[model samples]
Target: MRILGIDPGYAIVGFGALDYTRNTFTTLQYGAITTKAHTTFEDRLSEIYDDMTQLLAAVKPDAMAIETLFYTTNQKTVIAVAEARGVLLLCARQAGVPVFEYTPLQVKQSVSGYGKATKKQVQEMTRTLLKLPAVPKPDDTADALAMAICHAYSYRSKQYGVALTKRQQMGYF
Candidate 1:
């Protein structure tokens, strides 16, 4: 299975593409789509949409896994992120890619074997799982890769009818 994981944000949207086969992962690509801090919000959205459209075309992932929004104290930031996420979803829909949503807890649990694992812990586990030489930079990039790894585990568990974890046992369907 080819999976693309997305860590959505208006400022820096992180993306990672991976191919999962026989319980192993092959990293295809990982990077961030960054919008300038001073750009107009509308312009930022446009940039995100355009870049994501091109990315979807290039990756052609069988599934797009995205982090679902979590509440934050800053309404402004939350709203902006949500809008960016909307653009991402639309891009996937137009490309005919199947979309899956996962929360931070699910990602952490799947990657690090702990639901409340620290960000550094998850990053390290993701790096280990993918057998990368180093942790991906720009924290969000690592987070995106973790998301991909999480989806890969979930996908395999479903395919093999094995509940590897509590999340898999409950079923993400």
Candidate 2:
């Protein structure tokens, strides 16, 4: 299975693609779609949408795993990221890819086996899992890879007829 993971943001949308087979993960691509900070908000969003669409076309992932919005203090930031996430989801849906959302806690637990794992721990574990020479650059890009790893593990288990509970299926455990 090929999975695309997304870390959505108006200024920087990060993406990682990986192919999973028989519990092994092979990195295909990892990068960020960056928009100039000085650009108009509409222009930034448009840039993100276009870049994401192109990525979907190039990667042709069977599914997408995205981080769910989880901001409590910054309303503006939350709204902007949410809008970017909507565009990301639209790109996946248009490409006929199933989309799955995971929370920060879930991502950490899936990557590092601890929900309270630090960012560096998740990054290091993602590198180890994908057998990469080094952790992917740009924090967002690493995060995107972690999301992909999470989905790969989950999907692989499911392929063996392991029934995940609702909480686990939704990545809340």
Q: Which pairs, if any, clash in model 1?
A: none
TM-score of each: 0.92, 0.90
Q: Tell me the deviation in Å of residue 117 in model 1.
A: 0.7
- Which ten-residue region of model 1 has the weakest summed lDDT? 164-173
On residues 37-87, what C-alpha lDDT tens digit does candidate 2 reach at each position? Answer: 899998888888888889999999999999999988999999989988898
Q: What is the lDDT of residue 146 in candidate 1?
A: 94
- Which stretches of candidate 2 lie above 4 Å from their native place? 158-173
Q: What are the runs in model 1 whose C-alpha is more than 4 Å off? A: 159-173
**Clashes per candidate, residues 3 or more apart or on different chains:** 0, 0
